[model samples]
Structure formats: structure tokens, C-alpha cells
Target: MSGAVMDEIVMDGLRIDGCTVAFGGLRAIDNVTLDIPGGTITALIGPNGSGKSTFVNMVSGQIPPVAGRVVLKGQPITGLRPDRIVHRGLARTYQVPKVPKELTIQEVISVPLLYARSDRPLPSGVRSAADLAHYCGLRPAVTTRCGQLSVSDLRRLEIARALACRPEVLLLDESMAGLSLEDTDQVIGLVREIHVLGVTVVVIEHVMRIIARLCQHAIVLNQGRLLAEGAPQRVLTDPDVREAYLGKGFTL
Candidate 1:
């Protein structure tokens, strides 16, 4: 439970206050509020179309919330452009790999590195890119065309690309979906390694194995509202969470 508490950061904090998004009369996300502490991994889980992706989209600046505020490090970042958000220390990956078909894996990762390059003299951005790919276990596909990579390999490449941005916080959506057990384990390790580097991570996933293994804290949403938030084990066992996800057959 102590691990669920929000931690202070040099930048304000990642905060969502009373955020809601509506499509027509239906609320896709209803009045949800969440805080992701710096340097920790937070898991957001729910049944399909339960607003997990919409909420993350709002936070990542891909879509603006109809009502609510998103603040990062004490500054109001709501409605900011995606590129601006990245520059402000937020990076995001998608449920589907969005890599350019024409680009080599190296070229794909290099684009973000080049864009995020700082004036600070250290290893070249390319070297950092190499390290990111190697660290994420995508080294074998470094020279492969994005179109040539398998779904699991592309998933790894997407994560590597996000890391290349040098973001302080990352939003990973369904990163382990459609992966084999071995691939899932690899992703779990990559995610763990990323958090160890002091980068805050908010993961949206349907894989219970991942939620149980990688997240110290979890948030559950249903019908656009927050149903639960707490330690992963406790949250998973909650009556409300089970009802929302598993219905009557849910047990343990």
C-alpha cells in the first residue's frame, strides 16, 4: 500500500483531475482522477472499451478530455500537442505498432532520438538508440525493415523507440498483447528495467500476468469510472473489480 502513494518529482507530477470523455451521450471516461508517482510503474486495467485507452489518450495529448485537467510536474499540460508533451518528459506507445513501413528498425528508432537530442555532450544519440534497442531485446531486428518484423518484434521496437525519446514518464498500451510466453517474459523484464532507471510508467494491459508481475500499483476502470485502485493483488481480488470484469463466475 505504501508503494501506491504518489512520489514527488522535480517536475510537478502526473495528475488527472475529474477527467471525462464522451462520445455522443455515452461517457467513454467518466470523471476519473489518477496520479502516477515519479519513477514507479502503475498499471491501468479493465475490460475492453472500459476507458483505459481513452484515459491514456487524454493524458498523452493524443486526444483532449472534454472535462478535466491534466497536469505534469505542477504545470498544466492539458490539451498540449503530442510533440510538446514529449518535450515535457512524456512519451507514449500504442496498442498497435505505428512504425513506418519503409523505415529500417534502426531508422525508426533513430528518428525519435534525433528529435529528442539534447545539447548535453554524452554518447551520441545513435549510441543511446543502440543501447535502447539492445536493452529492450530488439537488437536482432536492428537492421530489419519495420514491415519485415513479426508482431512481437514490432512490439519490442515500439518500446525501444519510446525509450529513445528519453522521457521521464511513458504510457505503454497493450505492449504485451498477442505475445508468446517467452515474448511476454521479455517484455516484463524490459519494463522492469525501464522503471529501475527512474522513469515513471503507466501501462494499460489486459494480461493479468503482466499486471500481477510488473505493477506495484493498479487502477481499475469500468464504464468510464474508476472502480478500484490499490496494490495489484488486492485490487484484483476486489468485489467491485471482479464484478466489473469477471461477473458471477469470478472467484479468488
Candidate 2:
């Protein structure tokens, strides 16, 4: 990447500072801090229960942090509702992309367009449902019910819906889980296109290959704490990360 691109990413971002979340006696996230630069794709990787999803949750406001704050573009957005956060230029997708089973692919994608803040309109501008379907590679299934589409298509549809919000920051949590390699690659390609369009995305994924291909920065969490942060190659290679996630006997 050029220095300009590097600077563009480094200079602006979402900041998760000293954020913690607990469920009864169990601390799901413990004082984790991470910086997701603007105009860059970041991977949040760790073993199950490492608090990756919890961190994304705190940022997206599905759940509030027990302590600490989440900042975007230097403004605190810690405890805002999901819709409020979406309007503030951040949106997210779940591991299992949830579309209303009753809605068509077009209706699913257009829902966010109606509620999302108008300050950041979609690049294509609001248009026919077909336009959104074509943009999201769901043209073939435009009229299809959300329940009828395949899993891969659902994931793509989720991205399209998220983009309909015109977010400056997008958090993707395990969208590739359970997907075939080809399907994972398909979503990865779509995400890359979104990133190229200037959306900073933070993806929580277990597949290292996907991380390597899509993320410029990687943050590793283990047992509710940050274990490593940096380029994917370096962070994934850290001795502690290897032990906690890749297993001691594994090598990349």
C-alpha cells in the first residue's frame, strides 16, 4: 500500500478503549483495547470465547460495555442503540445473517435504506430494488424469499443490507462460518469491494486464510484479553497467539 493509503487508514478509526463486558460472574471481555483505522480492513481473530464477538457487540451497541467506552472519529458512541449507531455511520452483520423470512431479497435490502441516516447515502443512491439486488449480487434472487436463498447468498444479502445503511464503519462477525471455501471467497471478494469503496470493516473470523486475504491489520484476543495486534503475518505468528489459538503444535 502507498504511504498515502497507509496514512489514510492510520489517521482515523474506531477506538475501543478499556471496554469490558460481563455476564453475571463471567467476564466476556476484560479491558480490551483496539484501534480500527479508517479506510482499512481489520480482522479480529481468536479461539471461541476469546471475546471477539463481545468486542464487536460493544462497538455496535447490541450490548453495552460494563466499563470503558467506544469512540468513532473521536466521538464517544459507547452505549448507543444499534439503530443509533447505524445512523452514526457504523453497521454490522451477524454470524447467521438474519433476514425476515417473510421479506423478499429486495425488501430485506431496502429496509435499512429507509431507516439509515441520509447524511451518508449509498454510493448508487436509493433506487429500484433491482438496483440494490444487482449491486449485492442478488439479482437472480430478487424476488426470492429470504428463507429460500442459500446460506452464501444470505451472507451476501447481509452485506448488501449493511451497505444500504451507508456506514463508514462495518463490523462483520463470523459471516464466513460454516461456508464452503468457494463461498467464503465469494463473500471475501464482496467485502473487498466494499472496502475499496472506502468503508472500514472489522471482520471477526477464525479462518486465517480469509484474514490473510482481506485484512490489513489483525487483532488477537484470548480469554477476554488482547494477545496481539499488527499485520496478520506478525500477529498470527506471535508465540502467545499460536499457543492460545493455533495450538502449540501448529505452524503457519
Candidate 3:
């Protein structure tokens, strides 16, 4: 990363300071700290069991940190409830979307808006639940039940619902996992569209190509601590990052 770009990313956005999470006796996240620039796409990557999901969980308030703090847009948000965090302009999707199977797409999208306590209005061009669905590329009948949707469509619905919260930051936890190349490309396009709408996006993905294409900045974690962070092309090439996450001799 250029020093100029690094300076930009270090500006106020999302800040994690010495954050840690533990389950039983094992530390899932071990004093990791980093910054996610506002209005930019970032990739969080690591090998399995390297605290990637656990880091997102802590940021989105699904799991409380045992130490340190999380701040978004300069507001401290450590240990808040998930809904409370959403109300504070941060929302996230899961690796496996977990919507009520029986709920119609329209109904599912409406849930967040109904409970939205954030002062921030919905992003421009999205005025209704249907509009949100369309923005997310869900062109099926608004009445379609989530249960009947394809895996890709389900992922779209999950993102649309998160958008309903009018978040300033949206964390996508492997939104492209298990998708075909075409489906992954569609998601990559969707993420670009979302970024165009001015929301900061943090993507957790194992697909290095997607990360290379989608993120300007990449943060790598290994064994629950930050291993490397910088421009994607540069960070992915670091020997330590390669051996720890991408494996030796891997080429991006």
C-alpha cells in the first residue's frame, strides 16, 4: 500500500483496540487491533480457526469481548447488543444466512426497517422493502418465500435485510462461500454496488481472487493476531502471510 493510501485508511472509521475473545480456556481473538476505513471495502482473511469470524462477531456485538474496545465512526460500541449495534450504524451478514424459511422476501426485508432506531436514513434510491430487494438484485416476486429461494438468492436477501438497517458499515461473513464462479461474480458486483452507495464494507472470504478484486485493503489474521495488512496485492505476497494463511508456494 502506498503511504498515502495507508494514511487514508488510518483515518476515523471502525477501530478495534486490543480486542480479545475467549471461549472456555482458548482465546479465539488475541489482542488484535486494526482500522477499517470509512466508505471503503476491506477483506478480513485467515486460515480456518484463525479468529476471522470471531473478530466479526465481536465487532457486530454477537459476542462480547473479554478485553479492549470497538469503536465505529468515533463512537465506542464495545459489548453492546447486536440490535443496538445495528442502531448505531453497523450491521453484518452471516456466512450462512439464517432467515425464517417461511417469511416472504418482502417480509424479511421489512424486519430491520421496522426496528431501525438509527437516525441515519436509508441510502438514496432505496425507499421501500421492494426497492431494497431490487437493489440487492433479487428480481423474483416479492412474495417468494425465503425457503424456496436458491442459495444465491438467500444470500442476496440477507444483504438486503442488512441494508434495511441503514448501516454505515456492513460486514459480510463469506457471502460468496459455496457459490459458483458466476454467482460469486454476481456477488462481487453486488458488493461494488453497495460500496457505491457509501457504506463501508468488510468482507470475510477465503477466496483470494474475490478479495483481490473487491478490496483495496486486506487485513490478515493468524492464530488470533494480526499478521499483515496493506494493499491486497502487497499483503498477499508477504512471506509470513502466505505461509500462515495462503500456504507456502501459493500464488495470487
Error of 3 at 252 (Å): 6.9
Poorly placed runs, candidate 2 (over 4 Å): 1-11, 249-252
| Clash number by candidate, in order | 4, 0, 0
Candidate 3 ranges beyond 4 A from true positions: 1-11, 246-252
Q: Candidates ranked by TM-score, best first?
A: 3, 2, 1
Candidate whose lDDT is highest: 3
- Model 1 C-alpha lDDT per residue in residues 125-164, reported as the tens digit of each score: 3366566677778857577788888899889999988887
Q: Encode model 3's per-residue lDDT on 102-144: one tens digit a residue.
A: 8999999999989977777776777999999998889799999
Lowest-sum lDDT 10-residue window in model 3: 4-13
- The local distance difference test score of each candidate is 0.82, 0.84, 0.90
Worst 10 residues of 1 by lDDT: 117-126
Rank order by lDDT, top first? 3, 2, 1
lDDT by residue (tens digit), candidate 2, 1-252 = 899875555447898889999999988999988788888899999999998888878788988999998988777898888889888899998878767898998888778888886576565554756676677666465888998888878887887888888899999988889989877777888789888888899999998888988899999999999899999999877899989966878776
lDDT winner between candidates 1 and 2: 2
Itemize residue pairs with steric clashes in candidate 2: none
Please provide TM-scores, in order, for all candidate models, with all chains considered together.
0.90, 0.91, 0.93
Model 1 TM-score, 2 decimals: 0.90
Between prediction 1 and prediction 2, the one with superior TM-score is 2
Candidate 3: C-alpha lDDT = 0.90
